[model samples]
Target: MATPVLDKVEAESAASPYITVTMRIRRFNPEVSDAVVWEDFQIEIDPKERVLDALHKIKWDVDGTLTFRRSCAHGICGSDAMRINGKNRLACKTLIKDINPEKPITVEAIKGLTVLKDLVVDMEPFFQAYRDVMPFLVTKGNEPTRERLQTAEDRERFDDTTKCILCAACTSSCPVFWNDGQYFGPAAIVNAHRFIFDSRDEAGEQRLEILNDKDGVWRCRTTFNCTDACPRGIEVTKAIQEVKRALITRRF
Candidate 1:
């Protein structure tokens, strides 16, 4: 009958064939206690959606309390880097379909940092180490009116290190950084390499001295985790190795 046909159409409209992904997000409130906890959210998602989209849905529709950082919705912001399923990844770039869609996704703040709220971590220490490396180009003579001329080969020497976005992706993934806060970390060393190889920069010796400290480049054990975790595809381990070689070869 017409009634039966209408009922069938209504049922089809009401049912969704897509998968519902469950996310278990870690929650923390420093004002309440030092102990952090987890809260689970169930969201109906399209297979093509990224994890950042899922987080946006949870924050907007499911719970207003849930919090995280993201910008540029693309991977460039690097603000939403976190422990996604036990690995560091930019939330915007991580697609849900790529992961085990049937299983729940576990999201947590990046390790080796103090949680500020739900997902935000204090980045002061990370920036402090970044500043310690003297990231800017230092020249001896007066500023040239035009661009300093350099051969293509000179520019290529430090090309790999200049790709860093200051996202802290490499720094947070380092095992040495997780255990020792004093260590200069990979991001700092990468920045140092940017200028160390520059033909115009005259501060290589000074930068090498800074990196030669106990908590500096010597702390890196060459685990290559930083290189693996870097979203920009920088050769982090190689830069650190270059700095180590420079320290050993430098004439004091």
Candidate 2:
């Protein structure tokens, strides 16, 4: 039995699919220096593993000082959003094999926000924009004894917008947001859309009015970068267009 176990271990070792890949990371530590620098680390990892796994390897084995935010390793938490290979993506969802591993993979923090540390950015401004849109379903009058009812068609009206995980990938990818931090961004608009089209929500007019601000929906340039960056495959640009149409016609 001991010999069989040893043989199995040897066979697994021989079948290892590890490859040497260089992870190019943008390093910034305000406590140490204001200047941002790019550092490269050569790591041995399986291509099928996630980029987050590489970061963990570098932080655990190479440099313990590496700092970034992550809650659930799964993509649902939306905490590990970052720039991978010049595009915004969830680190855990991006597989190393999917991106070209022959070249150095670049990792950095999302743009248009204050960088707190390596791969970490201040999300207060992002959240403030989200709050401005009033993402929660707003109702008037007394509380209902039962849940608000809606037709299947009514629910489908805003189903696409409801998939938003608030990852900020769609927002951070926008060039308008990159230049102007005041822009409410695609994620905020998508959240507003979720409530605006809901049949049971009575605050559609109010949310639309809020989004009609100078820094609101008009800032979108329709570059489709938001749609391309969304990991959830949400039609972000279309939703923005729908909001624009609603604004003009005053109809939901």
| Per-residue lDDT over 153-242 for candidate 2, one digit per residue giving the tens place of the 0 to 100 score | 999999999999988998999999989688899999999999999999989999989989999888888999999999899999999999
TM-scores, each model vs. reference: 0.90, 0.93
TM-score, candidate 1, is 0.90
User: What tens digits encode model 1's per-residue C-alpha lDDT throughout 1-252?
Assistant: 579889999998687756899998999988877899988899998867899999999999999888898888888766988888888888888899998878989999998988899889998999999899899888887889999999999999999998887778889999999996789889999999999999989998889989999999989989998998888889899999999988988854
- Model 2 score (lDDT): 0.94
Question: Which candidate's lDDT is highest?
Answer: 2
Q: Give the TM-score of candidate 2.
A: 0.93
- Candidate 1 lDDT score relative to the true structure: 0.89
| lDDT at residue 22 of model 2 (Cα atoms) | 99
Worst 10 residues of 2 by lDDT: 243-252
| Model 1: pairs clashing at backbone N, Cα or C within 3 Å | none
Error of 2 at 238 (Å): 0.6
